[model samples]
Every structure is written in structure tokens, then in C-alpha cells.
Target: MSLPQPVPPSWKDLGKSSNDLLSKDFPFQGFALEVKTKTPSGVAFKVAGNRDAKSDTINGDIEAKWSDRKHGVTITNTWTTSNILRSQVELENQIAQGLKLDVTSSLHPDKSTKTALINAIYKQSGFHTRGALDIFKGPTFTADTVIGRDGFLVGAEAAYNVTEGNVTRYAAAVGYNAPEYAITLHGLNNLKTFTASYYHRVSSDVEAGAKAVYDSKSTHGGVGIEVGAKAYLDQAAFVKAKINNAGVVALGYTQTLRPGVKASFGLALDTTKLNEVAPVGPSHKIGLNLVFDS
Candidate 1:
């Protein structure tokens, strides 16, 4: 017989993250199986409990995947009663696709709204883990972008980072668009969150951005403000650096190959200093990444 795997150390401290990161661009080799409710019914079995005992059932789950920058992005939107489709469209419409005016109207006018639904289940449901410091890491960046006329600019950069990717294992994605301000969301754990970020290009050869994720569950979601910068290298490779948890910092180098492939190596200390933020741990994680064109 097997018992449930206990969540790792310091679980209650981490917040819910999305499974998207696991599928988009990660560099790791492993297999996973997710069990979801199907008909809400299970094989009948005898019970030792009293007649008042309620019947238990098992539901089936859809399989998830793990992708990296080396491959391409895999769009895995399931249709569980059509609501899934609606939600996906809603999210896509909201993403800030730096498109021109002619293209913007053709697509959905983008506006990141702060709604109750967005507040509750934007990307909340997924496998749960308990750990000292779970991480939902990824390298999600698009190669060639489809362009429109005016308002429709670039599709929301389908990439994931410490808090931007899918936030699957360790966090809620600190996501946003330039225009969108005052971001907010509520977790199933009854915890609330807020995030904001901005990007600017210096000399067209170098670009930089900064973002933060705050978890009401603790004194703060991340150790503190998460900041990073990216610089392009001959259109193939780029370098980046960041600091978080009000202390720990990191630096990384990434490269793109052909058009559909990407890879990178990162080094850091205390990477994600959850609350109480400890000293920076080891300072390096060599990652082989890949992402496919969806």
C-alpha cells in the first residue's frame, strides 16, 4: 500500500501556481500522471462505516506535459464542459498583444480586468505538492511573432520566469501587461495576491524589465521585489540578472538556436527566499531548455 506523499518542507508558505509552466519550456526529463474526477463515481465497494457514510467516487484527470525552450510551446487547453474554452478565450483576449490598430480590432480589444472569476480560478487547479521550496521554473519566449496593423502588437510573450511562467509548483505567476495596473487575485487558500511589472529598451540592443509577486498568505508572496534585466546578443543569445526576497540575487545566460530551439544556464543565491528569507544557497543551476512552436 502507498500513502500520499507529504508536501515538502515549508508548504504552507508557498502559494498556488499554474501547470502551464510544466508544459511550455522547462529542461528536465521526467513523467507525471494527474488523476481528476470523471463521472464523480467510483467502483462500488463495501464499507465498514455506518449507513450514514457517504459514497466515495474517483474522477479521471487529463495528462500534463513538460516542455522547454529547446523545443516549442504546446497549447494544452482541455474542453471539460465548454467552460474551459470560454476561459481560455477570455485569457487570450486579455493578454496584451503589442499589435497595431488594424489588427487590434480584428482581434479582441485587450483589457486585463480584475473580476471575481479572475480572482478565483484563473489558473488555480492542478497537482499539489508539499516542499521546503517548490519551484515552477521555465524559459518561455516566442521566436517569430505574428504582426497586425496598430493596437495588436506582439502576442503576450508566452514565456515563464520565476513568477511569470506558469507558477505550477511554487508560486502564482506575477503576470501583467504594460497598461494594466492594480493587479489583484484571491487564492483557494483564502490568500490574496498583487503584482506589477514594466519593461523598457535602452539603445534598441539592450532591454530590461522588473516585476514582483506578493502573497497575502504570508507577510509577502516572494521574499520581496523580484527584479531582472535582459540584454540581446547578436539575435541568438542574451544575458540576464536579478535579485529577490529583498536579498538573494541571480544571473543567467540564454541562447536561441535555429528558430524553434532555446537553451540557457542560470546561477543564483537563495533564488526564492520565501518568508524569513534565508541566506543565498548554492549559486548555480545549469539548465538545458527547449520550446516548440504551438
Candidate 2:
């Protein structure tokens, strides 16, 4: 008996380089699948006025790429009772070879289904500086503050690492989103964001990360910070956690299920100040995720 031969992990290597000198741009192709669900309790129950649980969603993203640092395309389909049905196709490319400039944009076809929740989620994520009490529990309510359906986003990123490989590196990016077309609703427009982060390899099995983020809108802007750690158990498994100043934290676990495929799941807990006086207690959330990249 030859025994079952284990397929070598590509994501572990795709995250790094082959020759080591670094070839940021190489032609590559891949495929991925995932089914995710989130349920809320405590604060979520209070804010959304839901006596039971939030809705469940199953989404899949199919993607193809030339390489880690090259151009590619992705198609995503999301299904939810609230969203009904939504799909997106995006194309991206890099320019200014030395400066790391890249342009990205996407198009929506069966769009209006999510007309109300898209903007709501952004606001919940701190769409502006003035924090709002935006919650995206499900399609049960027609939120007074948000518009549903058809939206588009275009953005770019640029980064040049003076020094590479774990010791230290800096990167910056900016992007924007807007409503594409709507017959009976309006979506927030001119949303902008920027991010900068540093990576430190504390040791062979561990690393630390720090980042600053800002987002701007017509009325206000938001600023936040995040910190995290990553640990590798071996060549096939790893785990990480990230926390923000607002008391939001996420823990993720991942492993290579096959040579060209990997899977992951993340659990998250978050609390927002609600832009009010008394602090709102943390809202608990549980989520599951899976990914496959060929």
C-alpha cells in the first residue's frame, strides 16, 4: 500500500516567495468556497428589537488570479432572505510597477435586493466620525436612516516597503463606495477610507500587527486602531486574533484542507458607543467561515 500522499500546501507558500528575493508579481489562478452564519444575543437582542435570532446567510466567492501581486478577477454571490439575491464581478490591476499603485472597481447586476442594508452596514462600521446607532440584524425592519439597494465602489492602493520581511513594513490605501442605480431608494455616496499598518516578526512561530484606520463621509469622519497577533502551530495550521479600541475583537483559525485549498472560520464580538452618553455593553456575535484558493 502506498498510503495516501498528503498534498503540499500552496497558501503557506503563496503567502511567501519562491526564490526569496521577492517576486511581488507572478501569474497565478485559484478557486474558493464558503458557507457562513452569524447569530447574536444580549445587546443585539435589545438594539434590533428581535425576540429571536438574526437571519442566516450563505455566500460564495469564485475567483481567479494571475498571482499574489498580479491582476485578477472575482465573482461573488450572496443569498439572504433580506438581500434576496446579489452578485458582484470585480476586475483589478496594478500600475506604477515600483510604486505599488492599483485600481479596483466592481459592478452589480441583480442589485436592488439589498438596497436598504448596504448603507446601514457601512454606518454600523463607523461610516462617519460621529458614530451612529446602526445595526444590520436582518430584513425585518425598514430602517429610517438607511437606503436599500444598488451600489458601486471604486478604490486604489499604493505601498512601497523600504525594507521587507517581518522586521518592519508600512502600507497605505484609500478607497470609496457609492450607489450605482436605484429606482425607489438612495444610497450613501462619497465614502472614503485609509489604512496604515506595521508587521513585526517577534519570532519564527509568532508575529504582531498594528494598524490605524480612518473613514470620511459628507458629514463626519471616523478614526480607529487595531492590534493583533498570529501564531503558526505548524506548516498546516495557524490562528490569529485582532482587537480594536472600540472593544471589537475577532479570533480566526485556519488550516490547509488540500494542496490548493484552505479553510478558515472567525468568531467576533463588538461594541459601539452609539454616539450617546452611557456606554453600550458589548454585543456578542458568533460567525463561521471557509475558504478555498487554487
- Model 2 residue 141 CA deviation (Å) reads 39
Q: State every prediction's TM-score relative to the real structure.
A: 0.34, 0.37
Which ten contiguous residues of candidate 2 have the minimum total lDDT? Answer: 42-51
lDDT of 1 at 14: 26
- Candidate 2 lDDT, 1-294, residue by residue in tens: 443322221111211211111111111111124423223321111011111213323333322223232354344444433334444443433322211222222334456322322211112221111111112222222212121112211221122222331212122222221222111111122225554444456678876656555665525557677777778999998887777888866667777877755665555565464343221223544433344322
Candidate with the greatest lDDT versus the true structure: 2
Candidate 1's TM-score reads 0.34
* Cα-based lDDT for every prediction: 0.32, 0.36
List the lowest-lDDT window of 10 residues for candidate 1.
98-107
Error of 1 at 98 (Å): 18
Per-residue error for 275 in candidate 1, Å, reads 22
144, model 2: CA deviation in Å?
38
